[model samples]
Target: MKTKITLNKYLLVSLLLPVLLFSCKKFGDVNIDPTKSSNLNPVNQLVFTQLRFAGDVTINERTSIIMTMPMVQQISGAYYNRYGSTYIKNKQYMSELWEIGYPNDVLNIADAVERTQSDPLKTNLNAMCRIMKVYIFARMTDLYGDIPYSEAGKAYATGIVHPKFDAQKDIYDDFFKELKEAGNSLNTSKDAVGQELFYHGDISKWKKFANSLRLRLAMRLVKVDPEKAKAEVQDAYNSGLFTDNTDICKVDYNNITNGYAEIRGNGVSVGINQYVDDGRPRVCNTLINEMKQTNDPRLQYIARAYWTNPDRLSDRLDVTDQVKAQVGLLGVDAGHYNYDNFLGAINIDYPGRGTISVPNGGQKAQLADFLVRSDAPFFHLTYAEVEFLLAEATVRWNLNLGGNAKTLYEKGLEAACTQLSLFPNGPVLTSTQIQNFKQDNQLAPGKELQTIDNQIWVALLMNAPEAYANWRRTGYPALIPAITAESTTTTIPRRFEYPLSEREQNAANIEKALTALGGKDDWTGRVWWDKK
Candidate 1:
């Protein structure tokens, strides 16, 4: 049985409970508003944080879909893709993750952790909050490098109006410490953590998630600090890791077609599918060709071509016929002018090829309907990722992670394919198909790192932040930067520029961070763990 948690009415209540209970107070005063009761439930705050972490449309659209996805060459051709695919910098788009993440995700979880940490009855809740706090900060520090970590979200708590920017190394060191402490603290004998979103209050699953997340962060240090990476990876591996697909960490959103403010639906899905027919995302040739070369069984399930109606250009007909489907499964090449001339390139006549509607507006291969549904699950971390990381550790550091690299690599492949079923209406692979794919794609000798990282690229579909980070760290599935004259830079961006608001509001701290970034707030500057 699938171990997925769904959003419900109680979760909605949990979302609004804190807001109803607490009111804002002026800075330099006590954190709690004098008008309302000081008593705020940490469980409600935890639920709200978890929902917003996966449900922020601004972050999902600006960072994941537009910026990270195209930068990684997973999908392209949408108007917003220029920001990442063609390297055109947009301050608003680049800053969305930081602007939204700090106020919405980080603050809420930080508050929850603070509220529950000292309470004996809230031990499990506090542990979950701490784990979530680390998860939120990990993404922030990964994307923007040094950020307001030690004092972030403390404005209301400790009157820290302008927090200092903590270095990425310091932030990562704390992440390992927090994850370890939190994972060790989760106990079934303690609080039940009512209205839980991820695991439905399953203490064991939360423990595994903490370890899996720690392993991920540990592996990110492979280039910058190999010894530290090996030690952390081995420690996280031995402590415990996701054993199978059932332990995959994800948030299953309800089928609510609400706006960006609503946390009941999948934000990434809403962002991608919200675009009109002409503006919908098309699979990039990089991803399509990668799968095509390997005869990947997931291609059909993940991508599809649509037929536009001649009478009504906005109407799209799903190309269900197999023969025509093959001819229509064409992906847009990044930085090409094909975004405007979609029909001209794929105008071939097939047996079932219907008449083209707008001569210049043919449908390219887009994500499958089920994959983009508003109710689709947002994958936080997966068992496949843990397995792949283990495989990499074994190959790169020669660590005995309970199995050889080949065995772990195959298991990772299997888990990657199998985990798709967790999504609403997602594809389910047969045992035979899984085995055949594994057999056909054995890890190449002396190319194990590249091969494993390449599979990781495929496995991280839709989760673009992780995909972008892994590409930067491993440099696998070598990609050439888009060479168009309209591009903003000659290379892929290493990190997002700090928000302009940071300069205006917190000038000193932002300047200190920028000084560490070599006196410029630009994408070419690498994060601490991202070594040359």
Candidate 2:
């Protein structure tokens, strides 16, 4: 009897152990405990991420967002120990957002999407997140012309170190399809869930955002398939899209202690050295003169007077005058004129702040002289931008907005003024300025498509990605190439070169992609929609 009892107890213990272990195990979802983390609240992080992305629209200014834009323009140059290769090679870093931000920041929503069981609680935000990924991934291919997509962001499980590039055409289709699905999934009736900085958990806003982006993507296909493009454009418009500045998505910066500040000072890649080396990117006369002609006051806000105090004794448009005088005429040794010193006359803050008592003593100048926090909301898409898009589209294909492209143009400029007013500096455009701007860029009946495209380019200043995309779609503005002694392709770089690592590590997969792509993986190969 005792032996039998003992055996029965042992059997019972064995049966229950698995249950206990399974119950005790942690798996499936990552629960974010707010009290334990030092990072900002989810609310703040979401907003900051958007700002960082938007601020990067200009290459080398705080944000590296427009790194690819300048690289394509051949305006890219080297200074200090740095070179243009960093910006040119940004395609490789596209995955960094997933590797770093996905698990760390955005995973809260991802987990919520995966693990939630309750109705209205199983986070629907995942689809929307994927919409953002569409932009990020599409941007990668937009720059590189072709890149791995289906296999991207899955390295941990697959052990696939390198992924093959996909044809730009297929990727474009996928982007459109994904965003369409994501937009459809934006049910405003669902419970407010996940981290949403731009919309504050507003599903309708997400729907609008998704649809607007779809229109932008559809417009990209205009050159390749006009019929399909028109169909998609109609679908986007019928979706009741974002029409006003209120629908415009942007990240408003907190007065103090935000992402821009942290990244501005704390980011290892940015700072005084970055400013001094790449600070030559300034407000060119093309933009400045246009604004000046309109009597636009925003010029003062955006561009501080470069030469606050040019040497009255010797002043010239180019830096060569200063360099020649400092080194040759002033009896300094050959090649002794540091480029950093040349920035001083332009009120450019160098490596450190304040006046350098000892001239040429090897102290770096403070770079506060460059573009810093104008303390404005970094734009994602604005009312002005959308109006311009519609205006150009109307002029090009005569798509349905009552054929009043002129009205859209006026609304766009008005919205532009309103958007500019949001900056801390008051009234960027005056009543007179607004009228003059309209008069100058107004499209006459039967105007060349190029005229509308050029005006759109003018409107997109500082919004680099949009400008670059617009340039690809319409090829307007006809920017003069850089005159510096640097060899370049006869045409602008159509797309980024595949990174060195992708070619070697994922050779088989890349070859498959090349075969699908008609046997050439050259950088100049146009994406499907780039038929123009």
List the global CA lDDT of all models: 0.82, 0.49
Q: Name every residue pair that clashes in candidate 1.
A: none
RMSD (CA, Å), candidate 2 to true, equals 12.9
Residue pairs with backbone atoms closer than 3 Å in model 2 (clashes):
349-366, 349-367, 350-365, 350-366, 350-367, 351-365, 351-366
- List, residue by residue over 18-134, the lDDT tens digit for candidate 2: 232224223333564322222323233232333334432222232232243343232222232121222222344433433334333233322222333233443455555656667
lDDT of 1 by residue, 233-297 (tens): 99998899999999988888876656777767788887887776557778888999999888889
Which residue window of length 10 is worst by lDDT in model 1? Answer: 307-316
lDDT of 2: 0.49
Using lDDT as the measure, the top candidate is 1
Best by TM-score: 1
